[model samples]
Structures are given as C-alpha cells and as structure tokens.
Target: MLGRKLNDRYEIQALVGEGATAAVYRGLDLRLQRTVGIKLLLPYVDSTTRQRFQREAFSAAQLNHPNIMGIYDVGEEKDQNFLIVEYVEGEPLYSFIPSPPQVVAEYGRQICLALDYAHQKNVIHRDIKPANIHITPSGQVKIMDFGLAITPDSKRLTAMGRIIGTPAYLSPEQAQGLKLDYRTDLYSLGIVLYELATGVLPFDADDIGVLLLQQVKKTPKPPSELAPEIPPALEAVILKALEKEPQNRFTTAGEMAAALQIVLDGGADTRTTIQPAAAEPESAPLSAPAEAPHTGPIRVVLADDHRILRTSLAMFLDVNDDINVVGEADNGDQALEVVRDQQPDVLLLDLNMPGLGGLDILPQLRSNWPDVKVLVLTGRDEDVYIMRALRAGAHGYVLKTIGEDALVQAVRDVAQGNLVLGHGVAERVVQGFVGRAEVTSNVLTTLEHAILTGIAAGQTNDEIAQRLKLDPQIVGEELIELLDRMGTASRTEAALIALRRGWVALEDLHNIS
Candidate 1:
C-alpha cells in the first residue's frame, strides 16, 4: 500500500506503526502539501471491526486538546477505509519508561487533562496505555488511538470473556468484562504511569488467560518498592487510580491531575489525607541548620528488627500524611544502606538490633550522615544506655512503651530540632545521676561505699584514697575488683549504677570529700 493514493488527495508514503486492528502510515496531503498520519483498516477485519475502525475517527474527532491527536478526514473507497490525523513525531510513551518521578508526573498530568477533556465530551478512550500515548522532542504529550473509545449511548460491542483492552493496563472491571465508565480510563492511566515511573507493569502474565485473571485478582506491588526514587506522593496517586473497583479510583481525571501537581511543585511528600507542615513555624526547630528550612512531610526511615512492629509503625505513620515512611530496615546494615540511599530527614533506630547494633552504628551515623537526625527508640531506659546513646550523637530517645500518638509527636518534634525523651527517661536520667538524699548505703562494704561515693561525685581513685586516708595503690586495686564484681565497665558507669540501683546515698559522697 506504500506510495498509494487514498481518495485521490492523500498519498500513503510508508507504514509507521501497526496494531491488531489497523496500520498507521505516513501520508502526504496533496491538496495542502502537508504530512499527515493515515490510519487504514485492514481489509481482512469483519464488519463489526470495520464499524469500530470508523468509530475511532468519529470518537477522536469530537475531542480538541493539545495533548490529543486531531482527526482531519475520514473516507472509504474500493473496500479501503481510512482516516487522516495530525502526524505527531515521537516514539510511543512506552519508550520513555522508567523515568524520573517528575517526568512521569509531567506526562501523566498531560494525559489526564486530555482524558478529562474527552470525558467531558462524553467520550471514553478505553485504551489508555503507554503505547497509545506519544512523547515529542519538545516534551508535548499526544494521546493517540481512540479505537476502543465509547460514549455513554454507544453500543456494547464486546463479547463475554474477550478483553477489549491490553490486559496489563485493564482496570479490574474491564478485565472481568464488566460495564465501564470514565473511571475505567483513569484505571488504565494509572497502569501507564506505574510503568513509566517504575519501568514495569503493575500486573502481567505470559498467557492472556492468566494475565486477565491476574488483573482482576492480583493486587500490585507498590511502585516505590521497585523504584525507590519515586516520591511517596506520586506513588499514592498511582496506586489510588489503580484501585480494583472503579468507584475507588480518583473521581475524575482532573482530580488525578491535581494530585500530580503536588509532586511537580516540589512538594513530593504532600498527599491527599494530610497537608504539609506550615513553612512558617511559631519557633524555629532547635536543630534546623542555618542555611534553609526543610519542608514537606517529614521524611522518615524506620530501622527495627521487629517486622510486625515495623509494619505497624509504617501503617500508623503513613495515615498521618505529613509523615511518610519513605524507607524501612530490619537490621543495622540495611539501615545504613537505606539512609545513604533514601537520605531521609529522620532515622528512628532501635538499640538492640541483631547485627551492627544501634550503638555500634550511632557514632558512625553521627560522623557520616550528620544531617540525618537519629532518634533511639528502644526499651532500654537505664541511665548507662541513655547517656551512651545521647553521647553518641542521638538527637532524641523514645522508649517502645510510648503511646502511638506520643510516638508520632516525638517524630515530629525531633524533625523540628527539639530533643525528645520518653515518659520516664528524664526522671531516670536524674535519678541515675543525682543521688537520693534520704537513701543510705547498705549493700556495699565501707571501703567500696567510700569509693563509689567518690566516683559518683566525679572524684578519681587518688583523691578518694587521700580523703579516706588509704594508700593510692589500695584504692586502685579495690576499684579493679569492684568493676569486676559489680559487672560495670567504667567508673562513670559504676557511679550511675550505684545511684540508679539505690545502693549509695548523697551523704556518702560528702563524708569522703
């Protein structure tokens, strides 16, 4: 059919693309001397297929949008049926898959606007896939092929068990051959964006039968899991539009476009459920750097060995919308990797992890990723542990026993540069440092009591010995034995232990000094 003239005015130059129903050819309009795209129906198609082919021209002609392909003419001669359309220059949208979140959202917004315009005119482009969309060099999105389009009053031409659109992009209702509305187009658009953002389909199978069934039954993996770079906000919009029930999807294409707008505006964390924290704060975050303030939802990465607890925390925090669990880790090594890759604003770390314990990596995190604030969330409230973590550069300390609401608030507090201490942590710090005035020493020998009091009051062994009228060597030897017997690692730690365990009184230290 190359170099053939249709209707004596348009000359077909070459076949540009082919599909199951028709072939698109590069054509020249002799009357206007302009290049145009000519879509010709294959002669082998039955009458019903021919009617659908003619319907594409009529359906697409009704819509006028920069993102949509324009239909110019339609005719039939000598059993050849053809339509002329604006010749757009670019590869199919599929070629640009696995793009950055911004690129995906940009094209997605354009496609949504086009679909909304078509839907407003009562036309539903049932086939909304990457292959049916085009991207030009100038970055314009052109939606093509309204072959499977339908109007509210159009006839139902589908046969039972026969899927009308690409299985991978089909909405669950379309997969089940159920009646469709404009939302069906939204569902298909979701699949296209999911693929473009992640470079993979949400649902796919080798067999057509299995593929359609998967679309109806399989819940897709979240796009962010495949492409960690995808912003949480964009992923939320994609997943919402891919809902199994049409009613669960975005109510309109325009609404989905607005959601994408948030991601494009650099507020990649702004979501549907919760608004971003106010940029202007009543008080500046204590830990905020001097250069610029962080905006958007507080991006957090949780590192805990407890899978159930991690999942529960993720679900809880995600509901807030202003706090996204951008990344998660079940061990310390994974924590480091996630922080390096995700660069989250907050790292909720556990002290008792299996490998590379929290303390093991706390100082490393402090020096290597100083910008990321560390919050130790553990059950160890002992003063030794608290001081060690805080001294190791932790910004806050929260116990696992904290209420869910308090935990959320603690995260927000830490993000804003305020230090957080779990309910009893502060009291424990005080009790473990300042000896109880009324308590008397009873659990230690006289020499041990004197030495412990000296250590608590920040005195050295030589000073304790001189005050106690004992040899300096004797004080040193006794301290070594005490350290072993009490199972304490250092003099400071022993001091905290004596005070915390209520083994010594404040009066004991005054007697030695």
Candidate 2:
C-alpha cells in the first residue's frame, strides 16, 4: 500500500499512523505537486466503521480553522476508502506533559479556539485526547481526527448501548450513553489540561470499569497537589471545566477559552502553597461512596449455568462501588427464586439453563417482574437467539465475549432503563434481519419508515426530529441502531436502501422540509 496511487492522483509515500479503523500516511498529490496526509481505511473494519470514516470528512469539512486539521478530499477507489487531509509536521501533545501553567494554558487556549469554531458549526469532537493533538515546529497547535465528531443531524454510530469516547476522557453523560452537546468536548479538554498540568491522569486504573466510574463521580486531587506550581486561578479554571454536570461547567468552548486566557495573562506562577490533597491516592477518590451525592449502587442478580463463569462475572461487578452482585443462580428455577427474593434492579439471565429454560421463563419474568430489567448473556450470537431474547422483553443482549468494562456498563445501562446490544450482537442480528426482510415481507414500523425517509431526504438528526416532533437526541441514537440494522456504510447507502425497498418515496423525502 506504500507505493499505491489512489484516485489516480495521491500516491502513498510512507505510513505515519495506524489505528483500529484507519491508517494515516504521508502521500504526494501528483496533480498539485504537494505533500498531503492520507487516512486510509483498514480492510478488516465493518460497514459501520467505514461509515464513520466518511462521516469524519463530512463533519470536519464544514469548519475551516488554523488550529483544526484541514480536510482536502474524501475518495473511494474500488474497495479502499480514504480521507485526504493536510499533512502536519509536528509532535503529539502526549510527549510534553508536566509543562508549566503558562505553557499548559497557552496550548489549551488554542485548542479552545478550535473547539469554539467547531462547536459553533455544530460539530462535537466526541473523542478528544492528547494523542489527537499536535504541535508544529513553530508552536502552532493542530487538532486532528474528527472521526468521532457528531453533528446535530449526524447518525450516531453507537448501535445498541455502546458508549462513545475514550473512557479516561469521557464526560459523565458520554460515559452513561446519554445525550451529548458541545459541553462534552469541553469536559474532555478539561481532562487534557489536567493531565498537562500534572504528569498523571486524574483518574487511572488497570481496569476500565473502575476508570469509567471515577470519571463519572470521583473528584480529583487538586492539580496543585500533583504539581505545586499550578496557581489558584488556573486550578479553578481546570476544576470548573471538570464539573460533574454540564450546567456547572463552562457553557461554551469560547467561554472556557476566555478563562484560560486570563490565566495566561496572569504572568508567572509566584506562589508556593500546597493543600492537604497532596497526599491523595493515585486511583481512589477522597470522597467516600457513602458520602457521595449519587444514588445507591445498582443491585444485580447473575443467572448462568456455568459456576466458574458466573462466579468470575459476579466478582468483577461486585468490586465496583456503583454495582452490587446481590445473588447468583445456576439454574432456571434458582434464578426465579433468587430474583423473587432479591428483587434485583437487573437480572443477568443465561438462556441455556436447566428446568425452566431461560427462554421459557423470560415471558413469565416479564409478566411478574415488570420492574426487573432482564439482560440475557449467551455464548451463541445466532440471530434467532437475539431476536427471541429481545422480543421476549429482555432489555439487553450480550455474548460471553463481552469485555469486563462493557459487561459492567451493560448492567448499569439496563438498570437505568437503556437497551444494550453487545459483542457483535447488533451487527449480526441487524444484518440477518435486513437480509431476510424482503423475503419475509418484514414490515417496518411507522416511526422506522419515517426515519428512513428522513435519511433518504438527506435531513440531519435535528431536522428529522423536528419534523417527527421528537427529541433530536432520541432520533440520533435511533439512527445509529437503524443504520447498523440496514447494513449501510453511509447515509447514501441507507437512503439507497430506503429507495430500493420502496419504504421511502422519492418525492416524500424532500417533502419533509
């Protein structure tokens, strides 16, 4: 791929970056006789990731700013999809941690300006980390990778209950898979600033589960404690940005930039005072679980036939203060009894159990225990099983291959009344269903038809939500799941499907507006 010429123009020269979904390389534009950055999609990614890659181009192309990376073109040569961006010569921000307040504030102010520009244009950079930031030779900051950015009308990629963003930098809302706004980016930037002020992340753990919870509620040790040079004013700005609630934080990126600018103008750090938080633990928070403002931990009951698997999962969940594994049952009857007695907030049910089979008891549990959010765990990812579980009223479906953090979060999400699909369950089930829909004459619901038409008409999430008289956030989330089921790589694909299936009339699409 290093010497390949794409679109008969850009010739790949050298690979510079590689990630799970895409690889960025230095390329030469044969047409313009200039160097360009080419982000080529990796071959193994699914249609969803490919769509996201295209979405990055659409999302970022709307903004033109010095601090933001420039988008040149998006192309697809045969099966290879690639994005052309400005070739940046710089160092990543991760290498320069523990910088002084002046340097931190200076870099932060530039980031803030870029974010301000993007936010004004309705682009939310969901994944903001030090690695995504760069500093050129002359000290110009360049923010790269808009792959996770979201617009008001963009289709959300989290099919099922998948949460977005890096766990360490996730905002409370993002962690919970709730509606996000411009403030979410601000929260992530706050984390970057905090890490720059002190060499350590405010929240760090080998376990993703513990780290996610810390981001949501755990208060951080004062930056001054980690590095005594951070002034009171600078610390105040950083902490405010890290506020638990968006309402408590800066309303906009521009507002946060102004605060950072004040710190930059304050001259130099001339104080030498330290607080009691200097002795803070690296991972644990100062606030006790009992004293925290949030509600009690989510009560959960695990029901799996295998003892070892059930026991290990129980232990993993029980370790987190936000989750409690109240009981375990290895058989269907035992699960019924335990759930009846414990009345757990969530029931992690295994389908292949003895006596009353997991499938057999699903309807009974749904009828009797309406309050219990049932989540099915299975080793099989057959489409039939997923449909059966969900149709029987299970709130969440996950395979045994689910990661530790994802499993814990699934339980938490179910407890909060959210639907979850994990471990390729969504893509497999959605693809299977869509594949058979034409033959089976599977009818789409009215809302589903309307949404498909919205996409066909090229309307944004906000536009669709407005026309349907629903919340834009709800529409955005539903779009992600819908796209996954449609097996579409982009809006154009979704729109084409709707047109071919006759679910959306060519005229009706544009009629919405």
Candidate 3:
C-alpha cells in the first residue's frame, strides 16, 4: 500500500510491517501534517482473521493509556478495512538486544510498567513479544500491536486447536491448550527476558511440537545457572514468574514491580545476603598456599531437569581450564542436597525443575550459605522475570542461547562479586521505569480544558478566538502551550491526553461555567 492515498487524506509513505492478517504502513496525514500508522486488513484473510482485527481495534480504542499505542480511527472504504494509529518512530525491543546491560535493564522496567497499566485496564496483551514493544528515540517504551490482545469480557479469538503466539514464548498453559489469563502474558514475557539476558532461547528445538512439549512438560534452567553473576534474589524472581501455575506466579504486574524496586533499592532483604549454610566451609585461609598454588579446579554443581541439556552444559563447563563438574541434580530438591554436601563455587539452576523449582531453593541456599553466588539459566526471559529474579537475589541471568565464552565469563564475574545480566535483560528493566514516566505524563492541564471545551461546543479554534474576541494566533499559541505544559510533545499526544482525561467531553464540555 506504500505510495497509495486513502480517502485523499492519509498518504501511505512506506510499508512498516506485514503480519498474518494485516499490513502496517507509515502514512502522512495531509490535513494534520503529521505521520500516522495505518493497519490495513489483508484482502484474502479468512472471516476469523477479519473478526480478530476488528475486535482488536475496538478493544484497543477503549484504552487511553500513555504506555499503549493510541488508536485514532477505524474505518472501511472501497472493500478495505483499516485502523489508524499513532506512528511511533522507534525500534522494537528485539532490535535493542545485544546493546548493553544497563540499557536492557532500563528497557525491561518500562515494559513491566506498561504491562501493569494494561492489566489494570482489564487488557491482556496476548502477544507481549519484543516485536510488539516499541522503543522511541527519546528512550520511551510503548507497547503496540494489540491485534492479539484479550479483553476481559471478550470471547477467545483463536479456534480450539490453533496457537496464537511464537512457540518459544508460549506460556505453559498456552502450550497445554488450557484457559489463559494475565499470567499467560507474564510467562511469554519471561521468555523475552530470558532472551534479552542470554541472547538465547531457554528451550531450543528443531520442531514446534518439541518446543511446545518442553514448555508444557519440562522445566527450564535458571538464569543464574547460565549467567552466574545474576544475584540469587533476581533468580528467585525469574523462576517465580515462570511458575506453571498462575496462582504460583505474581498475581499482578504492580506487585512484581514493587518486588523489583525492593531489590534495586538495596533493601536489607536483598537476595545477595542469603544466610550461610549451617556447615559453613572453614573460611578460606586469607592466603592460600602461595607455593603449592590452588591444586584442583573450581568445582560447580549443575542442576536442571532436562537430562540431555543439563549433561551437555555440564560437559561443556568441565572442559574449561579452571572449572570442574562436581555433581548434578535433576530437580530443586536434589540441588539443595547436592549443595549441602558439595558446596561448589557455582550452582546452575533451572526454573521449572520438579518438586520445588530453582527459585524455591535460592533462599534455602542463602539461609545455608550466604556467600555462594547463584546464576540463573533459563529460557524464560521477560521484564517481570528479570525483575523478580533480581529481587530474589540471582547473581546474573543467562539464556541458554549465550555463547560459551559469555557463560564462562558470567561465572567468573559472579565469583568476583559483580552482577551480570544477559544481552537484553538490563535494557528491559530500565525501559520499565521509562514507561512509568510516560504513564505519568498522561495527566491533564488547565488550558487543555479550555481548548477541549471550545472544540466540544462545535467551535473551531478561529471561531472560538472570534467569539472570545482573541487573536487566532493567540488561541493557537495557547493550544500549543497547553500541549507543552501537559507534557505532550505533539498534537496527537495532546489529543490523546485530552480524550483520556475526559477534558474533551463533546457534549458535557459546553456545560462548563
């Protein structure tokens, strides 16, 4: 649709994205002199796809949130249906990975904030993957593409046997073909977080079926196990978010944010200060035998439920010059027992192990031995998971997809009292905070009330200026000033804020005294 004009108003400038049911275009609004995004339904789409697209537009239009991409107009013309939305000039979260740790943490935080707001609005972004998350040049994170969203009162869009999201990010409940809720989105986000940290999928498989099976029936390694520098507290949070049972996961995104805040604030309960094991190793002599040098290699206890993957990782680490595999466990319970006996420098944990997942064992390990640095190794990477893991005291988060060099470096970093995060984990956390700022910007201003009232009374800015016997330039200047004062950098932003704050009450604004 690029180069095409719709209704002689919006001129399509370029094709931005193409999806299963629709295509997105960057279009110029001639009258408004601004760019906007237009989502046009594909001509050959099935009835179901059309229905879903329409439903998405309707549901999304109801939400007036700063963190959410705004829907401006929905209409059909010449046998084509389309939805007009705010055009965000930014890269997707997926594109920002591999940048830097602090960037990833910041971005992740913004995502969490956006999710929290959407949840409060009774909206579940069924597809919370990186592609749907936009990061503006100013470092604002806005969640877009609600095409697959599930509204609180709406019926399911997909048919009985069809899957909705990417295989790698599907929640266990989604993989199992069961009913879903807000927690399902959290699970997908967990995968995103994992990828951000480690730049790898938790469960890498050749086939979709295998990936789905793993998601539904198998446990994933903890983020810390893969990247040792992740604090134990952070690992606990990640594992908790990946919980198969919704009830076991955080009930609300706000609670997850609060927990993360506690971790970042260096509260006394920080995961790093876990109590030492009862049989603390005789403190290492401050000076090891200088001449005899440390004899054996650094020992590590590898724990994960997937035998093949666990064994593979263990073998890989053992090949390193300074590392030796001391023991392995298939579940959290076994991991604890092994740690009690082995007391290795590192513990590789999986989030989904049987009988108390890795997170459940973190506090136990801390209570028993506070000094042991725990790294999480998992496929679940989402802002929520990253925050939770950090709060729970994980030393670092590494995805299975990370290279051997980075994985090994993570272990060394943790052992040296440094915090480590996988490729995109840190950015997401920071973005979550940015998103909070954007949400706060949605608040209203006094001048906005006057402009909205005038518009509501069917008076153009020029006409209103005439009625008030004021210069049109002054009125327009006032409107611009109002937008600036309200923290809306653009006209669209001002309009959206006004609409959301109920300042533009078409009927009621005229009643203003």
Best by lDDT: 2
Error of 2 at 178 (Å): 1.2
lDDT of 3 by residue, 300-323 (tens): 888899999988888888887667
lDDT against the true structure, per candidate, is 0.75, 0.76, 0.66
Report the lDDT tens digits of candidate 1 across residue range 1-513: 898999899998976655434667888999999988888876544455677787888898898899998889999879888888998875566656677788888888889899989999999888788667876656788888787899867876542112356656777776555677899999889988998888888887533334555666568899989999888999999999988888889999999999988889974532222211122222110111222334467899999999999999999989886688899998899999999999998999998788787878888898999889888999876555665677677877888988776677677657756456676664443343233212344456556777888899998878887887655755786688677777766989999889888778777767655
> lDDT tens string, model 2, 1-513?
889999899999986645445667889999999988888876645566777888888988998999998988999888888888888775667656767788788888889999999999999999888868876656678888887899856668873445555667888777656688999898899999999999889988643444556777689889999899898988998999999899999999999899988997787642222121123221110101111222357889999989998898888888887778999998889999998999998999998777776877888899999889898988866555666677678877898888776677677657756557785664454444434334334366556678888887778889888997655755776677677777765888978877888778878865775
Give the worst 10-residue stretch by lDDT in candidate 2.
282-291
Candidate 1 — which pairs collide?
Answer: 287-417
Best by TM-score: 2
Q: Lowest summed lDDT over 10 consecutive residues: which window, candidate 1? A: 281-290
Q: Per-prediction RMSD in angstroms?
A: 24.5, 19.2, 29.8
